[model samples]
Target chain A: MLEYIGKRIWQTLIVLFLVSIIVFVMVNVNGDPVQSLLPPDAEPWAVEELRTSLGLDKPLYVQYFMFVKNALQGDMGISYYQQTPALNLVLDRLPKTVELALAAILISIIIAIPAGAYAAVKPESPFSKFIMFGSLAGISLPTFLSGILLILIFAVTFSWLPSSGRGDAAQFLGMKSSLFTLDGWKHIIMPAATLGLYMVAMLIRLVRAGMMEVLKQDYISFAKAKGMPGRIIYIRHALKNTMIPVITVIGLQLGRLIGFSMITETIFAWPGMGKLILDSINRLDRPVIMSYILVVAVIFAFINLTVDLLYYFFDPRIELN
Target chain B: MQKEKILEVNNLKTYFYTREGVVKSVNGVSFEVNKGEILGIVGESGAGKSVTGFSLLRLIEEPGEIVSGEVKFKGQDLLKMSEKEMNKIRGNKISMIFQDPMTSLNPVLTVGRQITEVLIFHQNYSRKDARRRAVELLEMVGISSPEKRIDHYPSQLSGGMRQRVVIAIALASNPEILIADEPTTALDVTIQAQIIGLMKNLIDKFNTSMIIISHDLALISEIADKIMVMYAGDIIEYGDKGKLISEPAHPYTQGLIDSLPVLERDQKRLNQIKGLMPSPLDLPEGCKFKPRCDYAGDDCPEGTELFEVSKAHFATCRKAQFFSKKLMRGVG
Candidate 1:
């Protein structure tokens, strides 16, 4: 068991290492960070000092090695645009993104499983058809588009909740509690719902497909033959097996959720990493952008690790391995 | 007769609807299983044997509907029950076994967990009680080291072991009726023989009636007391297994028996039945079997009603009544 776990950890590190290389290369592709950091009348001496201080005057390979070393030590260097610690700036905005991703997953699972399982059980009942066909719309409509429609419906048209921003003047962690409280839920409701509902639709479809496959399995038939109740047969036997694959997709989706939340956050003007990344881009804050990107990637990697752990529960063979 | 019949299916019709048309899978089929008897249902694929088993359990969801029929279990009409009530009786009183043990048992669950899950729900046993009973079931099913195997997933066990787990789970609640739908079809020859023997011993011990549905004639011949030969959703022949195997009365039955490869039988080679069984949607006019029957004639096509050929034998063949003596040697 220890050897197996050790092997998995080794593979995980390899994957993360590969992700870091891709991220580094892609972030650099838009050209020099120095050009964007400077204003109209910078003196040669000022340019030299900035380059020297920022470590940009070093060889490219030297810069990359330095960046890796600093990143490992939890110091992501300074933001070229904001003139602050890139790590601190990114971490400040981290919680909001994490919160949104968590809420989205929670809501998606709650909606997807029952809808999918019920649809599978009845198969072609009018109710089943309603679920199966209705989910098609969920799958087809992009989440960003859904977010826009929701913004119109709840924020612009109704004007009932705050259109943008994480919260208002009320006291919560660094803000008013109502912004983070029962009432704050009202504010986050639209944006989170917009993002989450689309995921729910995808999840429902995946779950339904998994359930349809599991329902035909021999254990299910055995349940039916044994005079076990339909509800029991569905939940206890069929649904459990169905979760193994669905869990895999959900884990992969959690990583996707972070990627998707970036746009939705900026659209709603929520104080999350999405907006932070956009702000960093507009300011050409090289340190902050690279650091924020790294934070998001790390979160994605962490969620996947937890999901990998969950695999053992769904399938015991995984745990044994 | 009334007391003897634990389960009786009458004039049952089950049809599946596709874009092409309605396929009459099980049409006008009737039979009865007495208490504690192993009633074997034998047929080729697409003969609706599995569908019939599904119908009895009311496991057929949509795209397929019970067009008409009465499935009476213990004098209670199962077909008329609400889905809710039927759900109550499903796993408690009647249990089903399936072919391909690998596909049947849930791979994620341990054999212990799978068996205990049924007991916990249907038998109202506590988790501890269920677990205890699960070990007993494992041991009873001839699984060695069952105490440890109970914690192992279905993939860890051999085909025979998985089949045993499937059987153990089926008998978990002491279901009055066990439906084994080709339970040993996916198993090796030796494993199949072992499982069949295990099932026979368990049935006698529990005194539970069974409906063993399979297309393998030889397998059923070993255990079934009364065997029914099914074709195109209808039961074409019915009798004692010995009598049916030794002296089949219907042309379809004769065809099947002749097709079975026998050991050291010197008289004749194994005869292959001619023509494919027609698609259920485009079934032949006149007799459903007319296209494939060597004995078929103008009147033979018209003979649709089942005719008694012996004290305990019945057939839907006109030739059985007119020329019963001639076909007896071919089958016997």
Candidate 2:
């Protein structure tokens, strides 16, 4: 198992390296940051000085080599717009993004698993039909639309909670998190719901389909013949078997949730990396974009590895290698 | 000696309400099993042999149900009992081993857990006690190193060993009536013999009444005291194993026996029953086996009731009288 983990780590490093190269090339292809760095009315000499200092005047290959070299030493240059370390800027916003992503995932899992299992066990029931219908609506609505609709309902119509921005946060483990405060939770509810709604729908369908399949296996019938309680048969035998595929999709969806929470974050002004990356993209912030892409790539690799490891736990037939 | 009847069924009918039509899977089958007796129900695929076993336990699932039946176990009508009450009987007084051992045991769980769950649920044993009994059950089923093997998952075991684990789980509660549906069909030839031998030994050791369902006549004849031959949702013939194998009253039973390859007898081609079983949706007007029987005549299309050939032997065939006469001549 240790050897397998080591091999996976090596593969992850190679993936991150490729991602770094791609991010560098893509950002460079988007045109020079110097164009947007200085004002349009700025003198030619001022532009040249900025370009030379920013290493934009160097050859593409040279600049890429310098970027990789600096990145290895934990230096991703300074953000032209923010005048701060690009890696630090992304890292500072990391906790907020992770916090929101975790909240969204937790919400999805809490609602999806039991609901999906219930739907599968009683596919013809009225409640199950309602759940399926709700999931269909959830999946059909886009994140931005859902975010706006949530604001319109809970914030505008009823005035139940704050519509936008992360409310007052408490410092926990050196990270400012809204998770610890009730007001923070109220502020986060809409944004997290918007971000997680699609995932919940997808997961519910996945879990339902998987549970239905598992319920038909011979082991399930054998369990029934053994006079196991309906609860044990459904939860212990059927649900555990359903989890292998569910976990895989969950891991993949989590990566997507963290990476593509931009629209929801924008709608709610959740102060996460999504907004930062979006603003950076508009201003051609190369350092922030490069570092952010690399970070997201690392997260994807990490999640994939975790999913592989989870397979070993869910099924005895799956060898770690 | 008059044996004590452990289980009795009267006009049991299990049907599947499919999109096409209602499939009369087990159409009004009636039989009984005696204490410590091995009753073998044999037939080709889709002949309702498995459905008969499932119906006995009330394990029939959605799209299928025991529409009508009287299943009396220990003088109590099982069909009339509530599901909660039936749960007390299942896996305690009665248990079942399914076909395909590779799939019968949950791959994620240790074999010990599967065996122990029955003990825990039905026997009311504590976790530790159940684990101890589970190891013993595994050893009883001929698994070596029960201590270590108990913790191993079903995927880690061979096909024969997995089936043994399945047998262990079935016999965990020492059920009086064990219904095994095609238990060895998924096993290799050698493993099939071993599993059959183990089951026979275990049944005698525990004094368990067994209803072993299979399509193999030879396999069933080896362990069954009474043999039942089913064809397209009906019991075509049923009698003492010795008499039924020696003098089959129905043509289907004869065909089943004749199809078995003999070592000493030289035959270039094996005898096969003519025609597939008619689809349950589109059954014949009268006798279900008429199209498949070689002796099918002008009068064979009429609905034929079961005819008594002997004191306890019966066959649902128009030519049962002629077969009985032939059998008498052979005996005399």
Candidate 3:
């Protein structure tokens, strides 16, 4: 088991290296760092000084090494706009983004797994037909459109909760302070809702297809023949078998959540790295933009690694080696 | 002959409802097995032998229904019971072991959990007790190192070993009647003999009745006290194993017997039965077997009921008297 874990760790590190290089190359494309970093009004000497200071004057390889060195030490240079340490800025907003992303994933899985299993079990039922169409609609619909639809309904119509921001800290973090409890949840509500709707739809469709295929396996028939309870068959036998494929989608979905949260974060005005990246893009803050891209890349790679481990645990046939 | 009959299936009809018109899979099949007797139901592929076993356990659900029948176990009708009540009988009192032992067991669960889980649900045994007894059941099936092997997953085991695990699970609850559906068909001939030997020993030791369902006559001859031959969802011939083999009553049964690739006949070229069993969807107006039977004549009609060909041997063909040695050659 230790050897298997060691192998996976090695593979993950290799993937991280590839991701790091890709992130660096992507951030640097389309413009010279000097153009983005130094304003046009700046003196030629000042441009050269800024280039040398940021290590852009050095060879690309040297700059890359410096970038790697700072990233390892958790010094993500500085934000181009705020001029604050990029790492600190990203991390401060990181939690909000992660929490929302996680909520989206959790909500999606909760909706999808049961819906998928039920759809599989009763293929011809009207509920199944509705769920099938609903899932398709979910998968095909744009995240931005769904976000807009949600904002219009709960925010414009109901007006029960704040339309944006992680509400108040006391509202979210204050359980003992009863008045702050609803406020905390309300603060994060719109962002969570916008992100969760599309994810729920995508996840439901994948889970339903997975559960349907699993239900048809010989082992399922064997389980039923053994006279096991229907629920046991669904949860234990069918669900476990369904997970290998679901995990594949999960890996893809996690990467997607981080990559696509830009729209969701923007629509709800949630203070997250996604919005930070966009803000940095508009201002052309090379350091902040690069750090945001790098951080998201690292997260995607890490999630993939964890997902592989989960697959290894769930599927007995999959040897970590 | 007078032993208490544990199961008696009478005129059972199971049809497969498909997009096209219904396929009459098991059409009006009937048979009985007494307590402690090994009754073998043998037939070629598509002969509805496995369907008979599945139908006995009420395993055939939606898309296929037991259209008409009385499957009585101790005079209690199985078909009439709700799924809840039928489930009680499936793995406890009347357990069934399916064909393809590899696929029969779930891959995800360990052999130990799979075996013991049934005991927990059916007999109300606690987990600890069930686990302890699961070992005993594994040992009973002649699996070596039952304690060590019980924790192993299905994929970890060999084909023969998996089959043994399947037997252990089937016999875990000490079922009154164990149904072995082509249990040996998946293994090599030597392994097949060992499986057959293990089953006979286990059946004798436990004193539990069994219905060994297979198409191989030689296999059925080893354990079956009585043999029933099925053709196109109908029993064309059925009687004592020795009598059926030596002097088959029905023309189809005789054709099957003559085509046997037994040890004594190995010196000569093996004979294969000519033509397939008639389709159940489009059976002959008279006898279903008339189209395939060598001794088929004017009287050999589908409507003819099984008539006594000998003292105990019964056959469905009407022209049994006109059958000759010359007609036997036409089968191969």
Candidate with best lDDT:
2
Which residue pairs does candidate 2 place in steric collision?
A: none
List candidate 1 stretches off by more than 4 Å. Answer: A12-38, A122-160, A167-180, A319-321, B1-3, B267-269, B298-301, B318-332
Task: Look at candidate 3 and tell me the lDDT of residue A67.
Answer: 88
Chain B of candidate 2 versus the native chain B: what TM-score?
0.95
Q: Write the residue-wise lDDT of candidate 2 on A66-147 in tens digits.
A: 9999999999999999899999999988888888998999999999999999999999999999999999999999998889
Candidate 2: segments with Cα more than 4 A from true spot: A171-176, B298-302, B318-332
Model 3 per-residue lDDT tens digits across residues A1-321: 788778867877888788778877777774775776667798999988887777777787887898899889988787756879988887777777777777677777878778888888888999999998987787777878987777788888998767777755443443222224567677666676567766677667777788887787766766666778788788888888887888888777777777668998998888888998888888777778767776777788778778877876786767655
Whole-model lDDT, candidate 1? 0.81
Clashes of 2: 0
Considering only chain B, report the TM-score of model 1.
Answer: 0.94
Per-model DockQ against the true two-chain complex: 0.57, 0.83, 0.58
* Residues B15-42, model 2: lDDT tens digits: 9999999999999899999999999999
Evaluated on chain B only, what is the TM-score of candidate 3? 0.93
Work out the TM-score per prediction: 0.88, 0.96, 0.93
